[model samples]
Each structure stands twice: as structure tokens, then as C-alpha cells.
Target: MIDARGPEFAQVLERCTVLLGTLFQTRNDILVFPGVGTGGLEAAVVNTLSPGDPILVATSGVFGDRFARLAEAFGVDVRRLSIPRGRAVEPEQLQEALEENSDVLAVLLTHSEPSTGVTNPLAELAPLVRERGHLLIVDAVSALGAVPAQTDELGLDVVIGGSQRAWHMEPGLVMLSVSERAWDASKRARLPRFYWDWRHAKNTPDRFLAPYMPALGLFYPLENGLHEIDEEGLPRVWERHRRLGAFVRAGVIARGLQLFADPAYASNTLTTFKVPDDLDAGALRERLAETHGVLLGEGQAELAGRLLRIAHLGYTSEDEMRSTLDAIQLAIAAERADDPT
Candidate 1:
């Protein structure tokens, strides 16, 4: 690993920040931290909100729920606007919540939820929060590169991202694009924070140094990944993900499997399907990995054992997806044949 404090590393860090700004479509300051996307979520929470501060969370799936829980852990009064699972949060729902919770300091939203393969209607939902003069914090970990965030145009105050998602980089790094309003909130925020302080992260003598020792190893790869995304062009990359999502969804339906997400708001980065009542989701995943060498994600929390998630995020190919689908068909066939019923 290179020395994080060195001039060369500082240069690399600056370049990455600029590239990340392009990715988020923001002119705001970008901060890097040495942790996963969750850390970025926590940083957004601690830096902009205080204990007992009221905020509205629009939750559609697991990640949205997780954001609510994270804020609650900080003693924030979280008013949850729960959308039905497999459905996107409607703009009207958010408007209603904001109207009811006028005291809310900010609004938390998940741009793309991996658990249910649903991407919330951020473009339509963001203005509701902004028009009301509330800070808008978004968990864009799964959406940034795969979909359009338009952080600046949307007036999003804080947009969090992770390296391991669409960037195709290794985990251990998280990035945030912070608007000036978020910085203003930070000045008044009463939440206890040290490592996650945005000021420390921004005001360091060398603007590139993090609050603590940085993830020295991830910077180069992160830069390289950003360059690759830049070279491919954002529109083309997004279209590729869109096509992949369509292909997977169509292939799954053709195989006689049912999708779990609403077709109107299905995620372009991943797809989730309802597992047949007779097949064990975990066993099918195991068989896919062990017998077919294809891995898929299991449903989380309440949906566990009843849903299957297939990711087509970064560096995925149609050939690979076809193989995965074939493996799923074979695994299901084998499992049903052995069913004593």
C-alpha cells in the first residue's frame, strides 16, 4: 500500500473525488471513507442530524428499513413511510408524509434496493423533499452507476455510494457527495461524531486526507474503475445494465418462475424472483454454487427462503446470466424430482 499522506496519494485521491463527482452528477464536495456503504449511511446520519431530530424515511425494502434503523440508533425520531414490498415509493406517499411530518429535519431514501430488486422513483420523489426545504439524504449504493442519480439537479443534500457495487471495486471504501446545505446542517447537528465528522474529512490541510488512515489499497483500483466507467460512457453503461435486467427478467419468466418485484419499478442492477413453495431457496442457492458454480443472493429478513435475487451489476455478461438461468432451471428440476410429495 502506498503512504496515504504522501503527495502522490493526495493527487490520486483528488482525481478520484473529481471522477466520483461526475458519477454522482454533482458539483458538491465528495468525501471518501474507509468502510462499506453502510458507513457512508452512518456518516450521513451523524453529520446532518441530531438526537431527537425528526426525519421521514421512505422505505420500500431492506436497505430503506436499514437506513431507518440506523437513524433510530442515533436517537433520531424516524417517521417511516412504509411502501409495500416489491413496490417503489410513490411521490404522493412522500408528499403526504412530508405534510404530516412538517417538523422533520430531513428525509432519507434508498435509490436502489437490492433485497427486493426495486429502485425507488428518486427523480419523482426527490423534489418533494427539496421543495419543502428538508435535507435529502439518499442511499445510492446500488444505484449510482447503474442508474441516474442527478444529485445536483435533484437537490439531494447527501448521496452515499460504495466501491463494491457498480464500480466493480473491492469493498472497504465508501464515498459521499455532500451539498452545502448538508454542510450547514453539520454545523448545527448535535450528533456525537468523531471519525465521521465531515468537517475533519473536508478541512484537512491536504483536502484529500481522510479523518483517519485511509484505505490506501483501494484508491488506485477505485481510480482505475472510475476511469473504466468514464471510458465506457455513463449512458452506454446504464443501457447495458438495463438490457441485462430485461434479459434476466424475461429469461426467468420464460422458465416459468415468477418475479417478486413490480415490473413497473424493477431494478436495473438486480432481479428478484419468488421461490416456488416446494423448493427451498437456500438449497437451490447451494446447488447452484456447488453443482453449477453459479451464485445468487438469498432473500433477507422476512422474505428469507421465499425469494431469490440475481445480480447483474458490474462486470456481468449475458452469457454468464444465461448459464446462471440454465443452472437455476436444472437445480429446480433436480430438487422437484427428489421431492417425496
Candidate 2:
């Protein structure tokens, strides 16, 4: 076990944390916590917003809704501006929401909607939030490592990410970067928080320790993953995901399956497709896993059993893409043969 306070562990922790800022192009203060990505999101809100504080949420998919729900659960006044389940939020709509709500403290968004595989145009949306004089907080858990998310450049107040997605690391670590404005908001925020308090993370001079000890198991994998990212370089990694995403989407289109999200808003990290109406999505997934050894992500919430999501993230190669496509095609073909349609 490594000492959470020792210099050796501190060095590695800093290395991993710095890599997140570099990945997202941010110079803001960062906090790396040991939990699911949602915890980081909760930290973002609990640290910066108080009860009844109004926040506008621009949601295009399930995760964005979840962020808004978290705000509502904490008694924050949530103003939802939503698109369909398989779409991206438009800047104009968010601008309209800002116009409608003059007391909004922040605008919450999901950078990449993994449920429907849509990546919102943050560069366009952030300006709208900033123009309205509100802080922009984003859940980038599924977007950061696999796509071009210029967080600081867009003037975002907080960008949250998880280690597992597109980072080539297992779950257990989540992180967020905070801007000067976000820190100021936290100082004024009256939310009750102990573990999720941003101060505990930002209090120490080095910004390494949590309120308690760090996750030693996650720390090692995170450090190694950061080195892997550093070695590959961000541009190359993003381009690879882009090319692979197109490869997956092309294969899906060639198979005559419809994409769940619009092509323009499709995510480079994952692609979602409309599940054939005649087939049970659960059966399809089970056969693919039990028979073909291919595990696919299921649809969430209302989209469950109606959508199929596939990934083209870090460490996934062209060969794997071909395998995934072939497996999906075969699964669909088998279902058709059984139904005679």
C-alpha cells in the first residue's frame, strides 16, 4: 500500500491528475476522487450550488437527464431544456433557456451522451452559457480522452470525467477540473457536503489528498493509464477513435441498421443503433455474449430494449471493430431467420 501523503505516491498522483488537465486543455484546479463518475458530477454540483439555486440543464440523452435529476434531488431548481433521447442539444435552445431564466447560476450539460452516442457541440454551447453570465458545468465522463474537448478554451467552469471510459483504465477513479469562477461559487455555496467537499481536495497545497486516503488500487492503474496516454499523444488517440467510430458507423449503415443519433451528432467514443423491432434486445445481447463472446451495452431508461450501443474507445482496435460488426450482423441475421421476416 502506498502512503496517500508520502512524496512518492504524491508524485504519481500529480502525474495522473495533471494528465487529466492536459487531456481536457485546462489549467484549473482539479480533484481526483475514488468513486463512480457520478460522484465527481455530484461533487461538481454540491460544491458549487446551494439548495434552491437555479441551474439550467441542457440534456439530449439519459446521462444529461441524470445530471439534472441529481440537481433536483439536492433541491436545486432545475430548468430542463431537452432534445429527443437520440440527439444533441443546440446552442440556440440553450440561449433561449438562458433568456427565459435570468437567475440561473450554472448551465449543466453532458459533453458526450453515451446512452444514444451523441456528442453535443460544446464549443458552440459554452459561448452561449458564458454570454449569459452563467457558469458552464459538463459531464465529460465518456468524451474527454476519446474526443477533442477543449475545456478551458471553451471557458467551462467544471468538466467531470471518469477513468474507465476512453482512458484505458478500469473503473474506480473519477476526476474534475475547476475554474476560478467555480471555486468562488463553492465558497458561496451552502450545500451540505463532507466527502464531496471541494475544499478538502483543494485545501492541501499540492492538491493530492482527498478528505480521506486515496484509492491505492486505482492510483496505480490511473498512473499507468496516464503514461499510456502520454506515450500515444492526444491527437493520435483522438484521430484513432474518430477513424474507428466512422468505421463502426459505416459498417452499421452497410448492414442496413439505422443510427440512433443523427449522424452529425454521433459520438466518436461509441455508436448507438436502433434495435430491430422483431428481436428482443436482451436475447440479442445474450446470444452475442454467450455465443460470440461479444459484450454490448444495453439501452438505459426508456430506451432500454429499443437501442444497441457499441464502443470505439481507447485500446479498441480495427480488428475488434470488425469483430463487433460481424457479431452484430450475425445476431440480426439469426433473429431474422428465426422469425421469417
Candidate 3:
């Protein structure tokens, strides 16, 4: 207990959190909470929005819909713009939505579309939201630390990310950066909150972390992860993720599979592929893991049995991706031979 709140540890935590913000180039203050990325999602909502505030959700896939549902649970007036599962929400589309929803208080968007493997245009969409004078909140649970997110430059009001994805930490830690505009919104926000309160400890003079029980152990690993990212250099890390994404896409294409998401907006952390004709998605994944020891991402609700996903992020090398590709190829070949048709 003392270790978690001591001045030395507090300084270390502050340094690490700030480093995480640097990865996004944000100058905003950060709030570290104990929970999953969903907690950060809720915090972003409750901390800055009243129950009746009309907010727009730009959704394309499973996680995006999940966030919209979370907002609905909080009683927010959620208006969702549903893009097709494999495509991104363009800036023009957002502009049109905002124009139509003149009373929109904020726009909730997922930075990296993990379920469908599309990376929404954050850099472009930022100005669009700013131009319309609405707050911007992003779910970057699987995007941060592996992709480019210029929080300050993009003028995002609240940016939410998790420790598990690119930080490679065990789950239950969610990080948030709240801009000044969001802080102002918090003061007027009417949503009920206690443990998720952002102002209590965040602005306190000597507070080490949050005002409540914190995920104390994650701070140490978070510091180490930030150090690793710093040592590797951000640009190099970003480039590595890009190359890995391309490699996986090429691998799937060489296997005669179609990519689910448009290549122009594909995410660097994950890639989605359409289920091959007459092939069972789940069985294909099972055969890959059982016979070749290669594990692939399972599909979400509607996408289930219709597509498969390949996900990788942080510290992964080319050889590992090659291994995954080889395993998938062999699995497919076996599945084909077994089927009579």
C-alpha cells in the first residue's frame, strides 16, 4: 500500500502516464483507472456528459456497437452512424452526421476498429469535429502505442486506451487523457459517479493516482512498457506494426483469401478476412490451432462464422507472422481435402 502511494512511486507513475500521452502527442492531463477498456469508455462518457446529452457514435463493428450500448446504458441520447462492418467512417460522413444532428454534444468513435480491422481516420476526423464545435472522445483500447494518434494536434477531448494491448500488461488498467474542454464539461456533467470521478484525485495537489483503489502493480509494468517503447523509438515501432500488418495481409492473400476490410483503412494491429466459400470459419480456426498450433482470432456476433481475424501488436517479429501464415495455409489445405464438395 505504501509502495503504491509513496512519493517515489508517484513520480514514477506520473512519468509513465505522461510517456503514454507522449505516444499520442497529447498535452492533456491523464486519469489512470482500475478496470478494462470498457471502464475507460464509461469514464469518458460519465465524466463529461450529462444523461440527456445527445452524442453520436460512429460504429462499424463489434466493439463500436459495444461502446454505443454502454452509452445507452448510461441513458445518453445515443445516435449511432453504423458503417458496414469492413469499412471506416469517413470524415465527410461525420460532417454530414454532425450537420444533421445539430444538437450533438459529442462524437464517440473507435480509433482502431479491432473487430473489423479498420482504422478510422482520427487525424482527419479531428478537425471535422472541431469545426462543428462538438467534443470528441475516442476509444483507443487496441490502437494506442501501436498506431499514430496525435491527441493534441487532433484536438480530442478525451482519449481512452488500455494497458493490455500495446503495453503488453495484464488486463484491468485503463488510461485516459482529458483535455481542458473535457474538464469544463465534467463540471457541468450531470451523470452520477463515485469511483470513476475524474476531478477528486486527478487535480489534487499530492494525489499519487486515483482517489480510490488503484491497480497498483500495473504501474510498474506500465513504466517498463513505456521504457521499452521509448527505447525502440515510436516511429520505428509504428513502422514495425505497419510492416507486420502488410505481411499478414499478403499472407492471407497468398492463401487465396479475401480481406474483409478495405485495404485503404485496414488497422495495423489486426486484419480481418472473409470466410472462404463453403468453409466453416470456426472449424478452420480449430484445425489451424489443433493440427498446426496456430491460433487465430474468433469472430464476434454477426461476423461469427462469416469471417476470421488475425491480430498482432507490439514486440512481434516477422518470423512469428510467417509461422502463423504457414500454419493457416496448411490448415486450409487440410480442411479442403476433408470436404467432399
Candidate 4:
């Protein structure tokens, strides 16, 4: 319903929320704004709780670690549950953390840790937070469409999504859903917030649509992306990701490469592998892109020189999978040839 002249941003925002709800399988409305998944996280923290509020963070990777830092920046009291990089935090550990921190107002969790390719057990973990009288907020940016997330059924208080990871779109906009639990908490939060504030944006439509200009063109492609998911169905989409993940993992093992994450906790959307000591993943990534036209993501931070990531999400095909394997084989062979010791 966007016209070139009148209230295009308003109409686009309306459609955007519907498309996001469909993508995330949520009944609540989604907010659209500048920045990617990180922006959505900021909004959730700034609006839903106040300074000095006790927050419990479950971190298994770099992105999860960011939640702790951001919460601290807002002057919130943070109790952290840090797990090994390649392993998911157990439900028992989370339960213990909550037990020890009885004053925790909220719990932050990451659904999929793309950095280490680990998937947390949110379904099992949410109930613990609820039982302890704490709100659960999930950073499901990578898991949202790529993996299955039933937000309402899981009792998640807030969930965040993005366009780049699973939606197969540009990275400017982030989508977030606020549950009734979070809505009630926001009533008493006294945090200083402006662009990331949810009060005015949630209660007043004009405030949401006025100064904040909507990304109109992104809406068109997001609609297309949601339609693609609808056509395939969420179950089929999840099955495809799992199948592809297995295919890629099998290929890596066949080539004698070591997997970074444990088999049971590994993410189905992405697979991280420890680069063979004989090979340089950075150079191999460049060669694969230049020689084979296959673009793969490199590792980050502490994992930089050690791991390589395969992103098998969103409109991914089996043919592309085969091509990627072939390209990786070529890179491995080339590396082995250079130093056949």
C-alpha cells in the first residue's frame, strides 16, 4: 500500500512486521530499524529493563559474549554463565546459574552460535528461566528461518532476527518481537534510551513511522523471502538445512578435516571445521573464490587461523553443495601438493 507520495514508510513498516512475524513464526508485531541483529539486541536491552537490574548471560561464543558487554554498558548487574567455545551450555548448568543468582530479572541466550557452530538447547532452557521468575531473551538472528524457532510455544519473552543470515537479503534491517512478559517489564524500566527506545514506538504509531524512515526496497525482497519459506514450509526448510549440514560435514570428514563443534550440539545452519595444519584457511578461501567461484566465511577473533565456516542457509541448493565440496577438495589438494611432507 506504499505510494510514491503519501505515507510510504508507514505502509512499508506495516507489511514489514507481517513478513517478519511469518518468518519468525510469531504472533506479536516486529519492529524495523537501522543496523543488523546487534541493533535489535540493543533495543531489547535499553527498553525492556532498567539500569542496575540483574541480568544473567549464557555465552558459548563471541556473539553471546557481546550480550554480557552490552548489558554491562547499560549499568545492569550481570551474572555470566560461560561455556567452552565449541560446546553448548547444558540445561543443568543454566539451572544452577539461575539458582545462585536469585535476583536476576532477565536471561539472555543465543539460539545458534555461528562463530563456533554450536546450537544451544533453548527449548529446555526457557522453562528454567520461567520457573525462576526471569524473562528469557533469545538472539535468534542466525537460527530464525534457517533453523526452526517456535517462539510462543517456547515461552520466549523476546526474540531477535535479521535479514542477512537466513533471510537472504541485505543487512541493514533487524526484526524483533516483544512478548507480553517483556511488555509488562517495560512499564517499570527506567533506562535512558532514544533511537532504541520501545515505549513511544510501541504505543504511538506516528512515533515509529515519523522520524524513523523505513527501508522500502528491503520490504519487497523480504516478502519474496517469506513466500519462498511458505512454499517450502518450515519443516522442509529445517530438513533441508540438516541434510545439507550432514552432506557438508561428511565431505569435511571424508577429506580428513576435523570438526570444531561436538556432533550433538553442532549447528545445522553452519558447520565450522578446524583447518588442517598443512593448509592456510585464509589463502584457501581466496583461492576457492578466485579459482572456483565459491565464497566461504573465515573464522573470527581467537578462531581466526584455526577454523573455516560453511554457510548453508537460505535458498541453498544441493548442486551448490556439491560445487562447494568440489572447490574445497581442489583447495586441499593444491595445499597438499605445495607441501607433500
Please state the error at residue 337 of candidate 1 in Å: 1.0
Q: Score residue 266 of candidate 3 by CA lDDT.
A: 91
| True-structure lDDT of candidate 1 | 0.90
Query: What lDDT does each candidate get?
Result: 0.90, 0.86, 0.85, 0.81
How many residue pairs clash in all the candidates, one count each?
Answer: 0, 0, 0, 0
In candidate 2, which residue ranges exceed 4 Å CA deviation? 203-207
Residue-by-residue lDDT tens digits, candidate 1, 1-341 = 47778878888888888888899999999988888989999999999988999999999988999999999999999999998889999888888888999999999999999989999889899988888899999999987898987999999999999998755589899889999999999999999998888876783435666557887888888999999998999899889999999999999999999999999899989999999998889888998889998889999989899899998998799999998999999999988887846
lDDT of 3 by residue, 1-341 (tens): 45665677678767876787787678788788888898899898888889888999999888899999999999999999999889999988988888889799999999998888999988888898888889999998888989987888889989998888755677777888899999999999999998788875483335555556567787788888888888888899899999999998988898888999999999989888998888899899999888887778878888888888888788878899889878877887889899958
How many angstroms is residue 271 displaced in model 3 relative to the true structure, after the best TM-score fit?
0.7
lDDT of 4 at 29: 52
Of the pair 1 and 2, which is ahead by lDDT? 1
The candidate that wins on TM-score is: 1
Ranking by lDDT: 1, 2, 3, 4
Q: Which residue runs does candidate 4 get wrong by more than 4 Å? A: 1-9, 203-211
Per-residue alpha-carbon lDDT of model 4 for 117-230, expressed as tens digits?
Answer: 998988888889888778889999888887877887787888998877655578777878888888888788888888877653552445336226556677667666776777
Choose the strongest candidate by lDDT.
1
